[model samples]
Target: MSTEATQPYQRIVQDVRQKIRSGLFTAGAKLPSTRELAETYAVAPGTVQRALTELRTAGLIYSHQGLGSFVTDTASETVGGRTDDWMPDAVRTLQQQVRDLTARIERIEKGGD
Candidate 1:
């Protein structure tokens, strides 16, 4: 996939991290599987795994052999230097959201008599 396509993976990772920190994922909550994640973002499983690996390396997620990955209790504190990893993804996601909302409103207007 092109760089543009992979950008959402980073954004997804960042969004997940936020959820964990906010207790949305909670400690030991089983996150969506790589396949589910890929389906949700229309990306390859490899891309999801790559993004998960970043969370794992940052100590924000833990994976069991046969089970699944989960958010850790102390993930926020441990992510430390990796905090800024989400900036580009967030910015891009924000930009896309604005564009999507704008387009939807435009389409609604265009249907008017």
Candidate 2:
């Protein structure tokens, strides 16, 4: 997928992963609904779903059919492994931030904001 297309979902994934690692989102804590997340992130619900899928695949979260997603009990342990292992994810997060900022700047320059 193109970086522009992937950036929104990756941004969600990185934010949630950081919350998990920081213990801000404790085990069993419910996540916001997909619609809520979409609104908050200013992306489509499908984008939020894509982000959730990544988190689930990473073992950081799980969902119930009728219920909302929740942080996995092992979320912190899964994300807080060796310090060296965090470099790639950290780099991706920084890159995402830069992209987001660039987009905002372009919008502002065009008087879209």
Clash totals, every prediction:
0, 0
Q: Model 1 over residues 1-113: C-alpha lDDT tens digits?
A: 34466486696787787787666887668899888999988889988988887776555776655567777655665444345455576563454345435544664799932
CA-lDDT, candidates in order: 0.68, 0.77
Model 2, residue 105: C-alpha shift (Å)? 50
Report the C-alpha lDDT of model 2 over 26-88, residue by residue, as the tens digit: 987989999999999999999999999878666677766566788866678778983334457
Off by more than 4 A, model 2: 1-6, 82-113
Query: CA shift at 10, candidate 2, in angstroms?
Result: 0.2
Q: Candidate 1's error at 20, in angstroms?
A: 1.2
Please report, as a residue range, the 10-residue window in candidate 2 with the lowest summed lDDT: 92-101
On TM-score, the candidate that comes out on top is 2
Native-to-model Cα distance after best TM-score fit, residue 88 in candidate 2, in Å: 18
